[model samples]
Target chain A: MMNVWTLFIPELYCLLMAVVFFGLAMSARPNPRRDYFAALFMAGVGVVVALACVRLEGTLFFEAYRVDLFSQVFKVMLAMGFFLVVCLCTELNGIEERHHPEFYLFLTTCTLAMMMLVSSVELLTIYVALELSSYSLYILVPLRRGHGVDVEAGIKYLMVGACASAVMLFGLSYVFGVTHTTYLVEIIHVLPGVIGTPAAIVGLLLVLCGFFFKLAVFPFHFWAPDVYQGAANQVTAYIATASKVAAVAIIMRVVALSGGSSKYLVDMLVTLSIASMTLGNLVAIVQKDMKRLLAYSSISHAGYVLIGILSMSATGYASAIFYALAYLVMNLCCFLVVVKVSHDGSDLKIAQLAGLHRRAPLLAMALMLAVFGLAGIPPTIGFTGKFLVFAAAMEKGYVALVIIAMINATISLYYYILVVKAAYLMEPDEELPRLPVSIPTKVLTVALVTAMVVFGVAPSYLLEVARAAARMLM
Target chain B: MIVPYSHILMFAGILFAMGIFCAVARRNLIMMLIGVEIMLNAAGLAFVAAALRWQQLEGQVFVLFIFAIAAAEVSVGLALIVYAYRRTGSLDPETYNILRW
Candidate 1:
């Protein structure tokens, strides 16, 4: 029991925080302002607990959960992302009238579940944790009141999520049908003898489909833009940033577990990567809503990360992890601006960004930094991530794929720059809201933007850290 | 005589196809919920079939887990459906064009 205790301290903190915050919520008559602090405090405790786990590394609780540098780094990153999300969400004066308390509870619970997901080494553990994360989002989406888009978004997300989970379960059954083992290490040992079978490949592809849906890659990406545009802006940020990070982590873990590449899987992945990047960028060109644009951008980014995963080597996995970290910061920064500038909670349209420089100079500047970083421009972490991934692909002699990604990266720049131009170059039509945001949001935004630039310039530090973390996945 | 994996997969295939059709074709919100439930059961069937075929613990264990998650999903799905019906007065998704294509 002590082993389980140490393994799940962060989850315990989150569970306790939810109970306490519920008590606070029930007694305090829905103090939106106070509850925000409750979220921050819980997230802070979570991060500390996650860090403490870093020092104690071992397989615990019958090897269902593994605590190591790999899990530790991701858990801490997730906790911090949750903390920032909580801080950023505090100012959502808009959601106060709705079921806001329930919203915060599920948000915290979902983050806890995703943290568990990265640590789960057993197939059963991973399945349940994935569902835990999904259910929370199903509730959070419709909790947004006064908008039909919110309800619609919630339903769409649920339907697609359920289907994906089903596909994954079906695939899991196939794997079990063949291997008789769900322990990843054991499964890997057995796979070389059996994975060449057609049923095994079909199972693999089905499971990959489930993951691709979460990552929002091509053929499974139809739900992304609608869900992004229909949901509240902050909710969209959670889906695009934190959700993608978790999905990418799982992809890398599963890929590593394969030991080496299967020709079938590699060929399939390369084709998917090419399609995802091309379609994601080409469609993003016409998006009017900022959230929709970011949705497609994230899909393309997933494609780039997939290129690294396809490399099926240590450097490939490390670069993918590094790119995910870089994405978590740069993409969150982009959405932070969207949340900050659209204070009244109106979905930001490309046209509305006109004259942002005049309305809020500092925010516009932050937006520029984030967008440029996303476009993979130098002096931003996005460039560093893209460089490492492309180099890894080249190492694998995927020359055509690398060239395609470069062209797509260049194409992505145009749309991202369009947003910046709208912010700085266009003129406003009316007197904009001169909003004074709280300090927590300001701090969160600045932290992400700074991380983006610093990581871009001197990437070796984070790069080496990612490299070490990737080595542990096997 | 135990059920074969092929029979189970056939049933699952039929159920899955039916669920997709109902989810896509039905205008009633409750029908869509039923479709999702059917689809979920189909997935669970796959696990059960695989467990019997392989004589392994993992597949049946997966089925048990899916049942647990499916229960949770149904509750939430029903709640959202209720909310949507109360607001829209009908489950016809064609009317909810408030979302962009």
Candidate 2:
């Protein structure tokens, strides 16, 4: 019994943190500093808790939830993401001070739900956990203060999300009908043999639509740009980083069910991958809002991650996992600059970053490294990640797919360089005062830059761990 | 079993189609929410039929989850709709277009 409790430590700790924030929210006085400090402390402790349980392995809840390296690694990532997003909440001006505790509460719950999501091995459990996280975000999107567009973004997110889940549920019913079992382990044994049938392939593809919505893949990507632009900067950071990591984990799990036997599924994934990469890169070029540009770039990155997942090999899965970690760090680095530069919590236009080098040299340098990393330039973690993913695909005899992805990478570089130029070269029309750099934020920027380069140069250790985690899926 | 699993699936599929049509074709936010609810129920109906066809209790249990989640979705969806309605005084999704690409 004690060991069982240990298996649930990370999730239980997150729940406790949520309860604490709930109590804070119910208090009469609105204390932003107290709320911020409480959140920061709890989230930091949450990361430690997740890391502490990384080596423990057990099944809980009658085998519905599995605890293993894959889930634990993602839990650590989620906790780290929560902690970093809280660190950016120093101003919290995008939201009303009175709503600060509630914001933290929803974020904690979302993180908790994702923790559960990563551990769930049963279909019903997966559905419930996914819904729990999505609902929290639905409420969070509209919580931005004084933005009419936030509510609109919220409605669009809710509608598209509902439709996608509904489609996923219909597909789940079919999967249940065909396999006669709701356990993924059993389905993995049963699915590939029948994957050639129209019902099985259709059911599996429809099921993927739900996670595709979360990851902002092509057809389901309509909400990302609008929501990212409309929501508070911190909220966008959470959505862009942590939620995406969870989505990638689940997608890898679901795609693995096919067991690499079906040509139809591979063909379908290839088409979606190409479409997402091309469309995301092409549309991102014209975006003026920095967040929207990141949103489009995220859509394209989802395509790249899909390339790793669709390969259905252990190396492929490992590379995708590495890519997710790299994305979380680099994207957070970019958002850190955005949050610091837009200290007043308004939407940041690309042009607004002019003279950023003069205003805050550290932030500008961080931004440049992050953008280069996103563009997959050499000597950054993002480059190493993309290389691993493409190499995995190449080993699987997908020469054409890898070539197209390379073209997409080059196209993506154009916009990323455009962002770099705006930050370093362009002069502001009016001279602005040098932006104040808080000590903690400066420390964070330096740490992120170091991690990007260090991980890029020496990926063998992280790659080994990712390979171990991917082994669990097989 | 008596009705045949294929027929049940076909019926559920039609219901699901209607739900999708209502969700996409309707202009009012409330109608769109209702459409999603209908889609959930259709899936639930299919799950029940699947339970009988497979002679397993898992699919039946899954329908219960679907019902509960559908309720949760409706509550959240309605709350968001109500908030948006108050802010803009319009139920038309087109009116709330401040966030365009």
Candidate 3:
């Protein structure tokens, strides 16, 4: 019982911090450094709380919230991810300050929401948690002033997000109507018996609609390209990485809880996975904006993660988590370079990176590594993640699915190399400004870039953690 | 109290679908934002209907959270709408295409 109470401390602390940040932002003289310090403190406390939860795993809050190895691992990763985003955000001095600290306040609230989401053992709980994370993003997206693109992006995200969520809730109601319970464990208890029923199928699809939207899979991914292009660079980085990881964790939980897969469910998911991969990668090749190119690239990567779910095996789940972690590093490295390039208040463009190598060799090299990793080139974590996810699919005899994913993976390299060539081989548009980055950001980028490279070379530790998480889910 | 939840759900669903159509089909930004809010509220209505039908606590619990999210969404969505309107002085997305970059 004592452990059960301690399980909620991270969430409670963040919630309290959110209110405090909000009040401080409204009442006091503006100090960006203090605000960032406060954010780091909140993130550090969150990390500690997540560690404590992992150390004290037990059913808590009437079993509606889980505090098992799975939730704990996800919480730690999410906390660290938020901490990095805060580090990147603290340096955004160009963003005009009209209620500035609200940024950190909302970020804390969003992190609390994501932590709740991973621990959720009920459909309704997940729904609320998903909304909590999204609402924060809705405000955060339009934070870029003098750029109507940011506003456009926010509107697109909201419109799509709201629609997908409604569809999800309607589906949940149907599931509740059929199962006569909202508890996920109970839902699992009853799923095998009603695997082919219309209500179950509709309910599950509806639930998936919300997540697919969040993950930006095909058909539901229309808003992503626009949003990525329109949002501030750092905000785009956070949205592209952390937002989707939380969604993937929930998707993994749902599939694992549903007793692997039925013919109908697996069949539907395979189609979605294949379509998302093909469409996202193919569309990404034509993109001119640096952000849009990466956005579509992310969608393609999302499809690969979905394929991981389609395997419905421990290896599959673990690989998906591993891949998500890889995607985080690769996407952030790319965004860090984007932030660095635009550090002097210049436009963020693919062509603008013509002579980055001449101006900043290290930045150019890091960006190339990120893109190559994204393309799944050799000796990069992207390759390792892709190999594991596809290998898991093959193990489960998803031959057609695996083959389609392989084809998509090979096709993705062209576009990724296109970006790399532009950075390295393209001629200069003048001497590129020497981006003056804070030491913290430089250290953070190096760390993220190192994680990507090292994981590709030696993935045993994260693989073990992913396996532990998958076992807990099972 | 068989308020005919399927019928209520269907009604909300149709309204929600219409809202989506409005969002996708219309070019005006504010209209699209209104459409989004409507869709969210429709889901909220479905949640309440299910809660009442089942006499369960979860649906109501979820609805309250949805309301909270909807409130947050509205504040920022409108702010963006106003910003777009100010820059272009027209809510037309075509005019706002300065960001195709």
lDDT of 3 by residue, B4-28 (tens): 8778878877878887888778888
Q: DockQ, in order, for the candidates?
A: 0.61, 0.89, 0.45
Write the candidate numbers in order of decreasing TM-score.
Answer: 2, 1, 3
What docking grade does candidate 2 earn? high
Could you give candidate 1's per-residue lDDT for residues A284-321 as a string of tens digits? 99989898899889889889999988898888888888
Candidate 2, residues A1-474, lDDT tens digits: the string is 887999999999999999999999999999999999999998999999999999989999988999999999999999999999999999999999999999999999999999999999999999999999999999999999975989988999999999999999999998988899999999999998888887789889989999999999999999999999989999999999999999999999999899989999899999999999999999999999999999999999999999999999999999999999999999999999999999999999999999999999999999999999999998999999999999999999999999999999999999999999999999999999999999999999999999999999999999999999999998
Once fitted onto the true fold, the runs of candidate 1 whose alpha carbons sit more than 4 angstroms away are A1-4, A431-439, B1-7
Residue A155 in candidate 1 has what lDDT? 79
| Top of the candidates by TM-score | 2
lDDT (tens digit, per residue) of candidate 3 on A193-242:
88688878887888888899989988899888888877777678788888
Ranking by DockQ: 2, 1, 3
User: How good is model 2 by TM-score?
Assistant: 0.99
After superposition, the stretches of candidate 3 with alpha carbons farther than 4 Å from their true spots are A345-347, B1-15, B22-57, B60-76, B91-101
Better of 1 and 3 by TM-score: 1
| Model 1: lDDT to the true structure | 0.80
The lDDT per prediction is: 0.80, 0.95, 0.81
lDDT of 1 at A45: 76
